[model samples]
Target: MPKYIVEGGFNFYEELYKSLDDELVDTPIPDDTQNSTNDFNNVCLISNLPLTDKFVTLECKHKFNYMPLYNDLVNHKKKYNTMERKTLKCTEIRCPYCRNIQNKLLPYYDDIEISKVHGVNHISETTLIMNQFDNVSCKSYIAGTCSHEYMCSDGTTMPCTNSMVTLLCNKYYCANHKYFGKMAILKEIKIKEKLELHAKILEAKKKILEEKKKTKLAAKMVKDLAKEEAKKVKACAKAAKVTTHAENIENVIISTQSGCVQLLTTGKNKGKSCSCAKIYQNNLCLRHHNLINKNKPYDGTGTNYGNPEQAGLWVQWVNGQEPEPDTDPDPEPK
Candidate 1:
């Protein structure tokens, strides 16, 4: 005999809804007794079995209460005949209690199959059963529920409910956690902006200082240049004054030498003119010369005149009288 098994933990109503066809007409079951067929052998077998709430049945006339037996059959398809053996002639399924094969005939009758298999009357039970499989939680946020809020692509704030759910952690988060995360991001952005602004300000200040230094250096250079130029002008002026004084002295020397009447005269005033022929050591006539030298003491008592003729002329000139004619002097003995 073929062993009958039924998987209980997995929600059959959800699977039934998932396997349904979209384009199908809603057909209601007839309440007429003649239209219903009953398999007496299957019904007798099911009734004779032990009465237990743990018993579950599949559409293939398989029954199982233990989860291991159902799991072994569903998981190990190569070792289990339920999935691998096509020659068993049990490809079609029928309702265990009602003996109805309407789902097999028309695959679109999923709602009716769900009701007959799981005893579910409404679609809400299917939703509740499916919700049990969703065991995901948000990993991005710590110690809070998901608020489903996020920043949109257009730089605006929007609700995260309609957004695509992330498969990594199911996009679950609390409102407080999401709010704090957003605030942290905004704070980081603000700090970065402030640092950039501070850097720009420092760069501007550095540039200004550099410009001031350049200006100061240029001013100093100009001042130094001006000072050098002034020194050059003063030096040129001094040199020109010295040259003019030297030229004036040179002209005076030339004029005195060319215009003098007594060029043979000696002493400090040698280039001057004189009226008398008898000149003294000074560049003057004997009378003026004797008047200036009269205060000197005489060394000898006799006359010291080497030339008596000039001496006589000097004596007469000093006496303010004309000179007499020349006369012979006494000879000296050896």
Candidate 2:
């Protein structure tokens, strides 16, 4: 049999649906069922089994470690003196925007042409080719990692004479990169904003120091006045003297004006406290401390464990195959 085939008729699947339902009953078989010739049979044979949903994951790595575009390329092209050298080389970097690898890798120019013109073909192409070996090709893939364009093209094929080879990843599906690229671009814009913020903070800091000095001077003036009042109060009080011949003192308890506080007479830090007993010994206050940091369990392997879309934890959900790693523990969890 061919690898794939198509069956017809909408009612053909009725038997398949009935097969799955335990409530289905046909106790009253029609007497002339053989003559009807309209029952579902050929539509769902054991051989016509629907293939289980399948998905393939591409393992793509960076091809060009650096971007093909360089700062000096434009200047060189304008002067007709410097040629913009291709910078895309083999490496382990993802397309900064798509977070993907290339499916197809085009050369900067023809290897054979450059080899013939410069007496060597491997230097440029081989170096670039070495960087992109991790690319993979699944059933469906697309390319959007390169900034190359086809020039000198007609209704037919693109002219290859001066064409720069493009980079692609093993991934064939491209819809994911439409949003992925935007995120990468946004990161670039954030870098610009960060630089501006740094400058603004420096200016703010300079003004703050000037204001801090003025506040310190004002605080000193108020503190000096409070000291004068304290000296006047000290002049009215007398100091008691201690005698060297005095015997060892006994524990004494003292109560404070606050009803909650009273002094301790014995034990550790004797005569220190009886009313100010602590709830816990740990450094964290009673209100904030915990004997153990409790963990809130995940409670779910995922909301819809068997369902891919509902689970949202793994890419395997995109296909109904339900990969085994999700159902069971992985050999390695990195």
Candidate 3:
């Protein structure tokens, strides 16, 4: 692979994809395709999506500082793996073998982010680019050891591939996206993409569940409440009807259960009690009629009937029939 000395502190990747200027010509690429403006511009405008998820391989360094890198990869992984926001700080370490300037490489961020792309963060466009450029690796994984004999994926390797911190990208300044500075950018792009994918799947699942639960629970509760309310309304109506038709009502209703229902006159029968005394007019009980017969029953100051028991005539409220009188001849016109 050709070496590309990366310069930092700006949108170098964007600029590189924009145009391979003559000044940074030494930065290695597969071949100059400046003639293709469209392709160049597209690459320059790298999608904020992850392309691939592969380890960045490199030549080994005799001595290295692992803490800072480890922390960076860890933080980046959160932003990349989940909805967590990641913080990327540039490193000032140089290439061990080539003596080239190494930009900030957050090992911690890369450490956690590079392992995943299966469930949520599956296809990282930038990760793909980085993997293509350099041999990417992880402390928890090993390449060329996919043999069933070693189970590095499960972290249960008999002859474990757990070496000098699962280091990949041993050499820097490589052509393509895995270049020292470019590797970080590519990783970032992948991180965002993966995080998005994970988040999308989670959100979709959550929404579907929420909708289903709401629909089922709300429907059931509403139905139950409606039934209870209907029962209450029916009871209230029955009570109001009883109150309105209390005294004048008769055994008009025949209930299903033979349950005692205070029956009322359902028919259209309008009348007063037949056993009244004052307006008797022959409709009076025996007492008042007898008094009239005697001609002296009320002759004095007070009104009196012939018999005493006539006052106890049960004043039953019966249906009124149109009155029919004997020898009654009506020939009046108003």
- TM per model? 0.29, 0.15, 0.26
lDDT of 3 by residue, 243-279 (tens): 7777335433321223212122223322322223233
Which residue pairs come into collision in candidate 1? 4-62, 4-63, 5-62, 5-63, 145-173, 145-174, 146-173, 146-174, 147-173
lDDT of 1 by residue, 1-334 (tens): 5544548767666567766643233556467664333332223233444324444455555443323322332233224545444421122333434543422321224432232222121223333223322333454334433445567788988654433232222333453344344454456657987999999999999999999999999999999999999999999999999999999999887555422134334555455454454545444544444444443333333233323555655667667777664443311111
RMSD of candidates 1 onward, in order:
37.2, 42.4, 24.3
Q: Using lDDT as the measure, what is the rank order of every candidate, best first? A: 1, 3, 2
Listed per model in order, the count of residue pairs whose N, CA or C atoms clash below 3 Å is 9, 16, 41
lDDT of the structure predicted as candidate 1: 0.47
List the global CA lDDT of all models: 0.47, 0.35, 0.43
Of the pair 1 and 2, which is ahead by lDDT?
A: 1
Maximum-TM-score candidate: 1
Better of 2 and 3 by lDDT: 3
Ranking by TM-score: 1, 3, 2
Clashes of 2: 16
Writing each residue's lDDT as its tens digit, candidate 2 over 1-334 gives 3343336634545666887564447455468766533332222121232222221112442222111311122222224433324333233212332345433222233322322211111233332323332242343233333332234546453422322223333212133332333344456557877898999899899899989988998899888878877766664442211222122121122222222133334456455333323433232222122212112112355432233333443454345444343232211111
